[model samples]
Target: MPIVDLGSIRGPEGPQGARGLPGLTAVPTDQGLADYIRAGKDSKTGQALDLAPLLDKPTILSNSRRVYTINNGPWGAALGAVRDGIRDARILVVSDSTGQGVGGSSMDSFPQRTSWPSFLAQLMDDLVVPTAHGLGIPKSNSSAQPYDTRWTLGAGWAAGATYVGFGGKQTNYVAAPGSGALVYNDPRVYANTYDIYYAVSNNATYGQLTAVATGGGTNTVQTGSQSVREIRKMTVVAGSASGNNVVQITNSGSAGNVTIVGIEPRLSSQKKVIVGNASVSGSTTSDWVAYHDNTVTNGWNAFSYMSAYQPDLVIIDLGINDAIPSAQASVETYTANIRQLITAAESAGASVVLKSMIPSVAARAAREAQYVAALDSLRYPFVDLFNRYGSYEKTSAEGWMADDVHGNDRIYQDEGRYMLQALIMSPMSLAAKSVTIPALPALPVEGWSERWRADQIPLTVGSDVRAFMSVARTALKPESTWTPPTLAIGDGGRKVVRFNGTTDGLSLAATRTQPHTVVVLGRLRAISTAANNGIVGAGQSAGSRSSLFVSTDGKLVINAGVSLTNPAAVPTTTQVFIGVFNGNNSVAGLTGADTAGAAGSEGATAMYVGRLGNTGMAQLDVEEIIIYPRGLSSAERTSLTAALAALAK
Candidate 1:
């Protein structure tokens, strides 16, 4: 092989070497790479790429094959799942406050602590994403708790969610903390980042019930239910006296013995009550006996026997009893309960409205302050009834309430009105109009007989029309019984008018000559032989026998002249009438006849220009009924009539 130095050869570029077979362009592999990544399997190299990046892309799979490709696929799926979970989430509120006073006295505290859970439930109802269920754990420390739980859970299970007890067995089946049995334990619960647990102080008289949470070897108390997992805040507070005002029954009073029990998250689930004593009185043993009797007979629990019916909003009105003592513990219990109620409702996906406790007396303003502080501290929306209706001092005299605690019907109605206004004004409310109609043009001429038809006024050979006319006539005698003349005229190449009636003794007359509309008038005459009977002077006898007819095509007009030869010969009481009729036989007529010897009449007579029959008729005259393609004004009618008379000549 001879090795020629290429640099030396150079052979004039050798004719571009046939273009080097067009360099093969690189095709995009990103699309293919994307597909492989979406396949969710290891690559040919047996190593799987981190799909986290691909998680940014969403893959739509159909028939086991990838279809649509979306960015951030995994994250989107996670978010969607979260949203759906939130939509289906529910919350259960448990209140353990019992009704009691600081001085061992029974009080009319129902559902002890104002039933804050119920109020919270009502608020939740207004939320965009409503709760699947709102179950109240009633009086977890009372005997009713177990029975209520069993009944409520039984219903809940049938509807789809489980029930979990919060406290011990007597009042509730204490489940392991954070177990799946608890609503919080369910991963779906986190669909929303928030959860709420509600508990209340059982006794406002002796010592307020405080939420206890396990913290590094000891129990701790928190202000709001949002802080701990198992521990929740008290939403409602109630109070009653226990023992001496100074030496209270710390934990044994009706208000002191509070607990929380089971709850169901199923749709339409009812509240469940738990164990607790009723407000006590007299000896401690006697009070305990009465509490037991009440629980056994009436199924009384920690709170009152109240239960919810899945209300959209709940209202809590409590703290009056707690404020009586002016004790810090009582106030704390009230505040804690409110906080818990709010949390539970939010967890359940509901909005809440707390009501401020009304004061009982002017001096009780201090108590009201404590109550207001407790409510405000919760940071939930609230309705201040005390402020709305004048304070106790102003409304108390007016009898706003029947008792010191419960409002009367009037007050309740007022409350209802407020609620209604709030609901309607809220963005979530809806309303609609009842009826509507399109507007139409108003017509002129009231009380005038009207008829509508396809107009043939243009009088074309084929056009149809409906004519409506009114005429009034007076008693008139024709000079002779004669038929009107009919004629035809041509306007350029078009057939303008074609009259087809008789014209024996008829005469054409126009009051004006220069381009005037001619009105044809007929003279009526009665034939009689006897001297006085002959043509009895244009009276009813003559008027009834005459008629005028014309075309609505603006080409014709008719006027009938009636007369009575002797005005005294006809009965003075004799009356005459006139009428006009349209093509459709629709008629309008006048009541009085043209008086005899009128200027237009040759002798004594009466005549009128009016509509004919109420609806149907043809032979009639329409007065002032100008006839011209272009409507004639008063001057034009006069001018046109003159012109026609001249043309007739």
Candidate 2:
């Protein structure tokens, strides 16, 4: 039987023989052989097949990523870099420039050449709201009024009088009540054409009212209805004035009533002082744009020139020039300019820092001394470089200056160090180490007094908002406790709590029943896009639960499960996350318009802030929370949206 089929003698397989124990099997597919060849491993040792140590690696790196087994470790030692895993290569250039120039030139030179900026650019890890100064200072023509004051005559402005004409141009007033003396408070008022005078309070300078005169021969200068002094002969050139001649009423010689009227302000070029910057044009360099207001040839308008850097912190060193004219100058004016700059900086979302003028030698010190004193009295973050360099000495050996005005090289270096130190020592900078939350945009409390405000809890304890949630560190589930997220400084420079989405959350008492609206503002992280991920939830049962959640697809679902995925998906990069529910409709984040239809209704029992109960743990960062008894109208919603957007930005 074994020798049978030779050539054409193949016999029909006699009853297919039983398959015997599938002997050493031939690979059924080509993959069998390919797999063995592709198994990159040492055949005998079973260890990963090692490639000959890489002889060379890329010396340059860029935005495109590349992997390499580095030799000569971090410090460039072959032995040090001998590691197992490959490193994602990147190029980082460090500079050690000490900066240039000295004295007055140093201010401009130091920023241009200093390498610290590069370092700072690298260390700016987390996204934080740049510290800003208060609201911007109003300019002569700004739409916004930094300061406003109105005094109507006992009767009113010439019946239907609206504005006053100076040099054929109408000078308008900001606002006027029904009846009172029309007094002006425009800061841009100038005496170049006509002498200008105003009343001062406690020598503080700001909030002064311009004077009015009536009698022809020797008119009495009066602010509002009160007489202050007398103007000898009303004189005018009938042309445009260069700068305002601000006169202090207490020291003036006017007590007559002149037809004085408040001048309305002109609008700012674009409502900001710094012209070009990252926010305006997209350049990232210096933190601030240095400027001097109304200098020779450098008009007030010229002060608007901006650099590429959008400053989060601005340090202004002024007063030296102003004090030089001490005989004709006042400390009040110096401080007024300082405040204006501060307000402008704050308006731009930059923290304000002021530096006193460097000390001067010889007779100039007498005038600068008073300026220094006044500068120190200001209630702001101040750095006194004057006193630090000693009072005043004529010789370069005794002072930090070669001349009476400019500082020497060492002086400049010291100033730069002090500036850095001042920033490092600031409370804002200190808090910046962890997280910096900006202030929340304030809601219009105008009609809030009438509406029944049940509860407006901030959920923050002092500066630490870790207790923002109802449940502190307790676990949502029975066995697993959650690690409460830490507090972070949020947009608008305010305290906020971070929710791990797993166990971090807050529960509030039910203050509103039906026809109520709840608003939650925070940053969300979409980790596990499981269904029913709670952002804000409260209800009797799952079906009727009023909750805002991230759907399984990472889209924002709000108001009883009504999903609004217009934004496509919330970015993982923590951004402004807003959720709103108005009993009937709901909106999530900055998505499509409100979704019509009833969201699941919840009983007026309790409200969950971040996570609802245990199952719907929301990975979030809560910046603010609000619950209104009544549903908000479309207009109100729009307003709220605008306000919240401003804060988040």
Highest lDDT: give the candidate number: 2
Off by over 4 Å in 2: 1-309, 326-328, 425-594, 597-649
Writing each residue's lDDT as its tens digit, candidate 2 over 187-216 gives: 322222222311211222212233332221
TM-score of each: 0.25, 0.29
> Distance (Å) between predicted and true CA of 342, model 2?
1.2
Residue-by-residue lDDT tens digits, candidate 1, 31-122: 43234334433322243223323233222111221111110121122222223442222222221221211111112332222222322222
The 10-residue segment with the lowest total lDDT in model 2: 275-284
Question: How many times do residue backbones clash in model 1?
Answer: 113
